[model samples]
Target: MSTVTVVNRLEIRFADLKKAGRGALVTYTMAGDPDHETALAIMKGLPAAGADVIELGMPFSDPMADGPAIQLAAQRSLAAGGSLSRTLDTLRAFRETDHSTPVVLMGYYNPIYARGVDRFAAEAAAAGADGLIIVDLPPEEAPELTEHLNAHGIHLIFLTAPTTDARRLPAVLAQAGGFLYYVSITGITGTASADEAAVKDAVAALRKSTDLPIAVGFGIKTPAQAAAFARIGDAAVVGSAVVQTLADSLDEVRAATEKTVPAVLGFVATLAEGVRAARR
Candidate 1:
């Protein structure tokens, strides 16, 4: 684990991950995925490959925003005996050697309710998690959850989709603590295209709501696609593509991640470097 550095805001952590001279390859995976014990192996493999941050997915029986690929991954992870307690333990184990990489838990709210918010927040914070991304409970419905996480000094990151209009941006930003996560594409996750012009527009709109660093995700796979996102948002997140990689073949997953983690993040890292270089 890297030394714990005092950070004023979660965006700083995101910025640090981007320091690899690439955009952030924010990979998502169910905690007890493929096999639960193998999760740490997967996590350990990611940082070296190119993953700046990890979206440590807490697998729920039902994932609303998720399409088939992620839903299946959740089932496998659950069947493998993955649970929030074990997931927290996995992260606790991770902190024994890896302290610097930012980890955010993304999932729905039902499991959280089942687990009890206070207990969840306490364990998550104690285990060294950086933040949370609850998909179903939008800002208006998030007071109880966000309040608890905030009280424990954990960030509750929110999703801002392309369809999020001006009226919605403020509400999203108000509930958002970490970096503002912008969903570059709409509908389910894992759809991709180079039409980032709309992404840039969303970024601009989000900028009006908050000065927080913006990390865009949804259907972002490959280095070229990552670069496009980094040009517009502060960071970019890659989910289902990598999840699919892991689901298809763990070896292929690692190989593919080795290619993408560095590939995508390297693109963002260069952008981060450029931003730093420009000041010189």
Candidate 2:
């Protein structure tokens, strides 16, 4: 039997999302990907589209784990003057208007390291960030980072893969707060295929070790794919697709975001329904 352990702030919210049998649809967008105003607008629109949680991408110069698409998005965001401080401010702005949903800050470690770890945690927590996902930082070097984040009640969500053997998984799960972000496929951000079977197998493998809510991500692009994952995992995380939808600049980007937001939300709603249906 899997033992459910509650270790961080995000676990509380994530647990609630799961008890309801509804997987969350978390989308990642680079803060000021193209420009700040539009990024803010995209953040505002996400909740209405069925997003239970939002993962704001903190643009950095080098996103080692990220693939071409997201790397390019980061470049665009930086070129347009996105910064770590500004991203937190953007989150704070959204919180001023609506504070119901949870938010997580997803980014590379360089920017955080540049800003100083302790200060970054304090600012992120103050800005209503519930979790942190630093892709490049491995568990060994995360003690300092995790300690500071936990002190402020922020979940340090960690990523694990199929190759992360039994010995490593336990350690990963131990330090892993929030939900475990199970990378469905290996590589960069936006590759696609509704490979539910593969993702399902991965989730099953992960379930054998820990009861932490698992959110399957990395190329989930359709409602059908979301529904399929919602059946196996507690929730699903979507990226690339949303960012790609808003990739263009100016009028084209705005139009695409407007269209993409509702469509993705509808997909999440459908997946949530699938979760509800699963219990009965």
Candidate 3:
């Protein structure tokens, strides 16, 4: 496929959701959390469970931006032999059956850096990754990775926050594509709730800066919060909460139980309901 076609998948998804009169429900999960097979199962069921986009986490030892739930999830996945290659393989498998739902690889920069940016970009593109959210990479230092990603038709999704000032906002949006991720809270993921009024104003300001669909993440835990964010932003991303659900469903030995996949998908369904109900 052409690079344009590969890259436009994200734009196409958001456009479809906009026409449907609702925000996209972007669900996040660690690639091999609990175990490889179970994680793949949960990923495959996400679209039917009401996810418009899937943020497949690339597990790292030090996920400084995430909270306890996601940190533990990364640990579990790594312990089960989760690696960048394995994560890409899982995506390739998922693509065998589904092609439409956009998948963004979300993680820190260490793994990608070690894997070689150009090679990683090529592999990610071939594996059906539509975008990437490298939490630690700033726009200034992103040229090397951004160049390769752009060549492969992958979006370098950048994160903006409540702390992003007028001067800093321009740089963040400079090379951002697919969608802009808005970190609702200043701290870390899954800690504290987002203030609705603040988010509304923040998104409004972002809209004036760029037309890229803004996805609000961090601090979104429940269906109510998802619905609230859906009304304000182009997409609502729920990560740590979903990870926590999966963790809760795991067996005593930290292996996947019968309820693992279903529990996560069921929670996603409820959140999707809230998001879909927003504009209706």
TM-score of each: 0.84, 0.87, 0.98
RMSD of each: 5.3, 4.8, 1.4
Compose the digit string of candidate 3's lDDT tens values, residues 29-122: 9999988999999999999999999999999999999889999999999999999999999999999999898999999999999999999999
Off by over 4 Å in 2: 1-9, 192-194, 248-280
Write the residue-wise lDDT of candidate 1 on 1-280 in tens digits. 3433434335666566456454555667678776666667777666655566778898899887887778877887888787788788888887788878888888888888999999998788888888899999899999999877876778889888877787777888887887888877777877555367877877887787787778888867665666677657777677776677665554433323334333333443443344333220
Candidate 3 similarity to native, TM-score: 0.98
Clashes of each: 14, 1, 0
Global Cα lDDT for candidate 3: 0.94
True-structure RMSD for candidate 2? 4.8
Task: Write model 2 residue lDDT over 82-196, tens digit each, in one string.
Answer: 8998899889988887677778899989889989999998888878888899999889889989988877778899998767878888788889877899888877788755477
- Number of clashing residue pairs, candidate 1: 14
lDDT of 1: 0.72
Backbone clash tally (model 3): 0
